[model samples]
Target: MKKILIFSASIGNGHNQTAKAMQESLGEQGYSSMIIDTLEYVSPTFHKILLESYMNLLRLSPKMWGKIYHNSERSRLIEINVLMLLANKLKKLINSVKPDAFIATHPFASCMLSVLKGRNNWSIPIYTIITDFTIHPSWINHHIDYYFIAHEQLKYLIDIYREDPEKFKAMGIPIMKKFREPLDKEKLRETFGLKNNQKCILLSGGGLGLGSMEKVLDGLNNIDLPLKTFVLTGKNQKLFRKVSKHTYRHEVVPLPFIDNVHEYLHVADLIVTKSGGLTTAEVLSKQVPMIVHNPLPGQEERNSHFLLNNGCAVHATVSEQLIYFIRELLYNPIKVDHMKQMAKRIAKPNAAEDIARFIMEDMASKAVSKVPLGGE
Candidate 1:
């Protein structure tokens, strides 16, 4: 079996989740793959400093992080320095892993691999899965072979490779196998202990739980609809404990970190979420309308923009807006259905499999081309 190495940094849940999804698909296609959290594994110090600092910025000064994110895109200094920091370590890791091909699910990893590929002239075939609706220039690197993007909408917008359309495959973001289809709603609801008669709302912030979950629930408390809100506080133990203990006007079910998030998503009538790219893709896969709440400045903000522009989701910057959007979607089944249809139009349920298949096919084609005229 061909060996594959996936580079995933645990900045947030998206990169690791995307990596696992791709790994699963690749494994099913008869490839051996291992995921490496290079930041944590290769350089634990950098992981805590950089990744923790990023989390703190998002939590404390999101607007500042936004400014830094956009401003840094205009300059390659940050990328260069980051590359320097990781290059030697990554080189050692690559030599150790000795994989046939490698994949990057995080921009940091992609950047490092791209620069190292050019610097060291090591061509083992590398690919990047841009796990967002919008493309940041940081993810761009000439040495990267193929770019798997969420859609064709921003293909031209990736300033560096506008001419190389062939390199950009709108294969969608790799979500897990379970998100391939929204399960039977009634049956799933019954299985999950949800009432059939009441409207259901699914609330989430990616795995880190960046959004103000308590405030969102407070806003929902004002709405008089017979609603059952299932709050998924992914990896947010504090939020889980708080929401689990708190009483609400509507039946509030606080969920711990779950592997089967897709199931609750399918059971939900309306979803209020902070738009991380992977979470957005998962919600879209479930064909549920979403209310994007105060997304953290950089990619999440852009992801929110894509969702709203695509007509599958509504945006909310404050509690009042959240309540309003929730009420609007609750009473408006026609609009909800329209949003679902729009989601269906864009969501690539088989994205993980498609990406894996694309990689293997490309590898096979290259192998065939390299064979001597009649000599294997």
Candidate 2:
């Protein structure tokens, strides 16, 4: 068994989800893997501040965050300084873990790992998984051995950024195995008390439930189609309570923090969601057409654009537009089917397993191994 260290950040659930997917995949492949929240491990105070500030920006002023994200992309000096600041901490962790390889699901972790590898000239293989459809300059590090991205377009984009195409692989973002497995759609609809004949539309606010669920649901209710609407409020208790009280012409099933999201996704004819990486990947895997709504300004906006450009999804920035799009998609089944077809074409259902196998094969082919699994 080989020991693999996976570093992820908690800015949102997407990065952590990608990290966990890889960890699970590696475990099944008989590898000893550890997942670390890099920010928390390096500095708890910094992690708290970074996480809270990000959430606050997303909740209050997303435009400001967007501006910051764009500006940061050009700040290579600043990025390097941040990396240098964390290099000592990362070095300490690497020395302690003594893992055979490193995998990063977050850009920050990738930068830190790149710095450590460059400074120490470590031979351990470093893989960076871009958990979004777009690539940011911050994610590009010359020291990284391989880059796993969502699509071929992203690979081309990264090539322009890094000037190295050989290091990139268009491995779709890793999702949980359950998402790839088939579920009985009719059984799921029955379990949720939805009508078998009606079309089921799922509205999700990602894991934090961090969007305007009430307004979106209200907009969807205005559509005249006979449909079953499922609202996943995530951890938003207030939104759940408000949705639970509301009655609509269509059946509205209000749920909070569900673990069986894949089942709901399986039964859904279309999904209205914010374009988080993991959620979008899961929806694509389920081959459900998407109406992207209120994507967070930076990566999510890019994710939405990718889906739209690829013909797999539609975008609705407000509730009214959401209603119109839903009406259009529902009334136009052919269009929905087309979107689903595009989704299926791009979906990487076996990404996690593929990544695990690639890492194993690459490690075995290397002349010098770093650390043995479960050994000193």
Query: Which has the greatest TM-score?
Result: 2
Cα lDDT, model 1, residue 239: 82
Q: What residue runs in model 1 are displaced by over 4 Å at the alpha carbon?
A: 77-82, 159-163, 205-215, 368-376
Measured on C-alpha atoms, candidate 2 has an lDDT of: 0.84
lDDT tens digits by residue: candidate 1, 287-374: 8998888788889899998988899999887777778888899888899989999999999879999999999998887772211111
Candidate 2 runs further than 4 Å off: 76-79, 206-212, 371-376
Q: What are the TM-scores, per candidate, against the unseen true structure?
A: 0.92, 0.93
**Angstrom error at residue 157, model 1:** 0.7
Query: Residue by residue across 178-288, what tens digits does model 2's lDDT show?
Result: 998877777777897776578898888543242456666667767776788888888878878877888877788788898889998888888888898888899999999
RMSD of each: 3.9, 2.8
Clashes (backbone N, CA, C under 3 Å), per candidate, total 0, 0
Task: Give lDDT for model 1.
Answer: 0.82
